[model samples]
Target: MIYLRRMDYTVIVYHLLFHLLLLTLGFSPAFCFFSSIKNTFKWGVQSVGNAVCSGVNCCDFHLNDNVEENLTKLLKDKLFGQHIAASLLVEALSSHRTHKSQKALGIGLHGWTGTGKNYVSEMIAESLYKQGMRSPLVHVFAGRASFPDGDEVKKYRKDLLTWIRGNVSDCGHTLFIFDECDKWPVGLIDVIKPFLDYHSVIEGVDYRNAIFLFLTNTGGSAIGQRMLDLHEEGVIRDKLKFEDFHDEISLSLFNEEGGFFKSDIIRGDGIDFHIPFLPLEERHVRKCAERQFELKGYSNPTGRMIEDVLKNMLYGPTSNPIFSMTGCKRVHSLVLSVIARLKLEL
Candidate 1:
């Protein structure tokens, strides 16, 4: 009985002494060192819901491969008829990344519907984030999806500023994608003006480490006319050049010819590269069909299915019969539908 009581007392005393020791060391460097270690490890594991930069090594992050070989390959192999946009995208991303002071890219992709504007944006994001479009640092904003109403639009400006400031301050590397910017309310894009400024920081937040991509049909009419004229002049769609779209598209945005044509971003010259996505020709549509079949691993029926998709899709400019109304946008579903019918017959 005496031995048992003595053992219990000793254990209690040891614990009390150990706790007192810890309390005494709390004000010392050792306590700070251990506390920092715990915090660094905790933050390294937690995905950080919003932006938590409260650790010794909180800013340490994986270095992403800047767009170079991967982006060029993605553009040439995946996309069909956007030579100029693809080239300009590579150039802008590469050049902008190297700029020590400005270190940001503002790309404006414009063309008729289904001209691979969104697809090109996706490719760029995919290259940056190994996990693809779902990257935490990639902020995609479509006016309809992000700001559904007037109140939401009003709230967006403040929310957007907070988001960019928080994320950029934490790591200084981020990608901002604004899809369908033409649909955004008159001054919604202007909210981003302060961040896009060439100056180092707006509110102590360095935004130079960011990339901004705007996708819209803002210059559709101009693109369609240029292609129509080229078709009439015996210029094959494949041979079309960037010089063909040098002015009409972006110039229209600043001109205020239409209500939708007024974008302060363009007027302020905030956009760095304005790459025009030309209308896709029938051959481009066929190429898209072929790629879709390749993705699905279907053989033999590929040629016939390609012909069927092309036949069903309507083309504009009855005189020329050139551009696909939906570009390759409808090609994937159309190909899938044809495959489904074929299987039923089989």
Candidate 2:
């Protein structure tokens, strides 16, 4: 037997203690050893211990446990207008997370620009993942940006399948967002139809835990017209229900000259919910402006400043300009300009 130096005993004790802490925190002994050994050898024990702890903290999955509570708070606090869309999204996600599902959850968000389709998607991402849209598990695709040409449908289809399969294989709980879906070439969306279907497993991957969101302005006109008709009929916008406009939005999606036009996804009921985002009124625009000012670091925006922001916005229906034409899409730039002008006045 060989004699041991005091320094050697110290190192051995430190190593055992470090791994003991990892084991107590639920890490496997093998995983702890693999994650820390290289660093320990290179940087000495103290630095390696800190590095291992930091790595473990940062690398864990970031999905929060109180999904419904967090999501409801985000929607109610930050989002303006579209009460029905807000409620439906929270309910759908809550129920999906709580129970076992047979098919991947599919939500199609249809609306005009700045009507909170993308904003709602971001809220959902934030609620589900600590990193929000930046999470590796969340994949976003734009139709015009990703698949611009009608002729390249075959190649796009093949690549799309491979990407979805690989991502789901890596993490079964994944989110796939397809923005501007209406701009994708016809018949292209059917490429992922098998994955979205009720199949228990597709090529050894169980996709039931995944979520797919399709955002489009395909049914904006019809939705806007329906809102106008409802307003004329004295129906309060907040009081409007999903059933009120679901059929109209569905018809537009089916007949429109876009991705979902007569697509099997629609005919086969692959899309679980076709959520319609309603047009914003003048009050809603004001709320957006106020929030924008706060975001731009102006906490207490005066009434004059808010009115100025509103005056710069274009609202419509030539006969009666009751609603914002561009929603709150241009609110950020508009707020900046207003702030600059106000500073000059001061």
Which is the leading candidate under TM-score?
Answer: 2
Candidate 2 residue pairs that clash: none
- For each candidate, give its TM-score against the true structure: 0.79, 0.83
Tell me, what's the RMSD of every candidate? 11.1, 8.5
> Which residue segments of model 2 deviate by more than 4 Å?
1-60
Look at candidate 1 and give me any clashing residue pairs. Answer: none
lDDT tens string, model 1, 1-346?
A: 1122455446555555654576676756566457555655454345341234322124334234755778999998999888888888888887876657474678888888888988888889888765457766777888577776655656877888788778777666678898887777666677777777677877677778788888888777788898888788888776777778878875768763432356556677787777889888898998888888878878455567789889989898787677898899999999998889888989
In order, the Cα lDDT scores of the candidates are 0.75, 0.85
Q: Report residue 171 deviation for candidate 2 (angstroms).
A: 0.2
Error of 2 at 333 (Å): 1.0
**Candidate 1, 94: how far from true, in Å?**
0.7
The alpha-carbon deviation from the true structure for residue 259 of candidate 2, after best TM-score superposition, in angstroms, is 1.2
